[model samples]
Target: MANNTSSSRTDAGALVRYYLLRAVVAAAWVAAAFAIGVANPVAAGILLVLYPAWDAFANARDAQANGGVRANIPQALNTAVSAAVALGVLAALRIDPRLVLVLFGVWAVLAGLLQLAIGVRRWRTYGAQWAMVLSGAQSALAGGFFIKSAAAPAMPAIAVVAPYAAFGAFYFLVSAILLAVTTRRRGATA
Candidate 1:
């Protein structure tokens, strides 16, 4: 019983750190995107590629912190998918903005589903994963919207995706705060 409690607390602390890191990174990325993504195509393209690359890195790191890739199959797969999408976006940017949007749409859908799976799995062990679950659902929905937007005549700018990162930051912030609170409460009881 004591071991489980200690382990749970440790896991919660690690998750809190992960969430905080994600939140900070997302916030900074969104700020940079909004600042530079509208007028400069090159900057926008870089931001587009960076988004998924960052996701890949973040997911891989989170998986490693929690366990091996094998133990975190969803995140591992997400990392791979995000990395592939980053490469695809880099290659497709010269072709068309619509193509880039489509690629992002596909990536978002896959990553969101994987995120949902991770959240569900974590929820079974750590109790306060509601924010992550909602984030995943919203990300999937946003992905469909991105696909529809891509089909429209107007080209989508990188700033258009800033809201997605903003929402991710919000969810990560909430999750981090929730986990921190939970940890504190658990420690106090002990």
Candidate 2:
């Protein structure tokens, strides 16, 4: 019983660190996209592609830390989807820049659903996953909007996508804080 408590504490600590890291990276990416990438097409393209690749890497790492890709199937699938989206974005950039938004929309919808599943699963093992679940649902809704907007004649700029990252950062930060509070309360009560 003591060992279980200790293990859960360790897991909670790791999750806190992971969430903080994710939030920071996402915020930084958004800042970079708006401050620099927006001005330079090349830079913008790189940032666009990097976003999903980073998500893939982040998801994969988180899955490994939690219980490997096999145990975290939703994250594993998210990892795969994100990586594929990265490649798709790269191709779209070359073939037709207009396709980038479409690709992002598709990825957002799929990734959001996967994230929702992961959050639901995590909530069972560890509390304080409400923010994650909310983020996932929001992402899905935003994706539909993106898809509808993508049909417009003009190609959207990097700035249009930056806000999506901002929301993700906000939710991640909130989730991290909530988890930290929950973990602290558990410690105090124990």
Per-model clash counts, in order, read 0, 0
lDDT by residue (tens digit), candidate 1, 52-166: 9999999999889887898999989999999999999998898887888888888888898899999999988887899999999889988887888888836455866889899
TM-score of each candidate structure, all chains considered together: 0.96, 0.97
Report every candidate's CA lDDT. Answer: 0.89, 0.90
Q: What is the lDDT of residue 123 in candidate 1?
A: 87
- Candidate 1: stretches off by over 4 Å: 153-155
Cα lDDT tens digits for candidate 2, 1-190: 7788788988998998999999999999999998889888999999999999999999999999988999989999999999999999999999877688888888889999998998898888889999999999999988887777778835454776889999999999999999999988987887
Best by lDDT: 2
Candidate 1: the clashing residue pairs are none
